[model samples]
Target: MTGVEHEPANERYAYSRTALARLALSDELRELADRAAAGVPTTNDMWAQPGEVVGDALDLVHQAQEALVRAVIYERQKHTSWEAIGEQLNMKRQSAHEKYRDAVAEWQLALQEPHYPAPSGAPVRGLRLHEAAYAPTTAGARLDAWVHEHIPAQRETEHPVTGHLPALSTAEEMVQVLDALNHLYGDSRTPPDPKARARVIERKAALLDRIAVEQGRPEAAQQAEEARALAAQLHAEAAQAPD
Candidate 1:
């Protein structure tokens, strides 16, 4: 909720695919911890609120299910086939597709538009079902905070949760965007839209330019230049793409 409250207007379009996957894993882990805490049996003769406990446990189950859907979306983004997904779920391909088709389609739509019409006909941003739940900036911070509180050992040990993940920064965000674009548009069976790729490359170039100016780093400036050149090349190729 704090993430939603504090999201900047300009920076609230789409989350990188990596963020979605990480958020899904974190959410599932958090719910599992909650369920474990709730399942602790009453050892002493204390006044146990059985109804409240049961309700909390049920809620955790529902939350875990939602997290599973997020995980499925991440898999789908990687071009994983429905048959593979169904095999893992111990069900038929059609059954798995029918179950998750809406969620996957909604995710694809949100990635492109990232906004929906509000009741008053105003376009609302970053409050969609997926964005509100897993905005990259805040989601990463929230997970780090939760880990420190619930899994302090992660901070101390060489655990992937903390060890493998780099600190959240503008450069890190750009890198994630590039990585997601690679998975979506790079060497895939489906023909990617060159214009769309060019547009993203142009944006990356602009961001890198901004970073170079603000950071005054030679490497950043070089990256910015390279990105601009690549973007120009992409635009030229896109011009040659079939209409």
Candidate 2:
């Protein structure tokens, strides 16, 4: 005959008893009880009627877990003592040490893998909707080449006509570049200043003249002359305005 030994019921209830004692007088416990009474169910089973909610909750949990794992690995990698790590994480030092020992070793080994460069001219992957809409691809051997051709060269640093104008300070250059960029990209809604607008028109007229000379187009030359005449009329009007 085999004899069976029964465990004490008090021993089995020890954890619950300790928990109740610890929480008996706490405001947190009172708040939790109040919330429970208000029919705000805390369990996943209670919210399972809404499939989307369940899925979203699961996604959040997964993201939170990944962040926690990454943080743990980072802390360990940075040579923080287990006791200090436990204090930060609000856990027992021994428990923290045990929980991450295997993960630390695994991550350390993973860090040893040699990093390889991405293939040249590889298509950009995983851009979000807004980013994809704003940044389009251009055919070039490299990103630098693409930028050089597609992005306007920093507004020919010196003005086309009067190399006499003071070199734009960094801030002024930034403002000018940003203004041009906003115009090109449809980011600006306000009308530009009248005086500045006149200057731009004059510069454009000069550029048109140069282009007409290069292309040997009689129509382009006529257009350039018309532009110059318009510019002179605008300048005369501005000069006559009361200061």
Best by lDDT: 1
Best by TM-score: 1
Which residue runs of candidate 1 sit more than 4 Å off their true CA positions? 1-15, 35-53, 121-126, 129-134, 157-243
lDDT of 1 by residue, 25-87 (tens): 666667677676757776732665757767767787887788788778878866789999999
**Candidate 1 local distance difference test against the native:** 0.65
CA deviation > 4 Å runs, candidate 2: 1-49, 114-243
Q: What would the TM-scores of all predictions be?
A: 0.57, 0.28
Displacement of residue 203 (Cα, Å) in model 1 is 2.1
TM-score, predicted candidate 2 vs. hidden true structure:
0.28
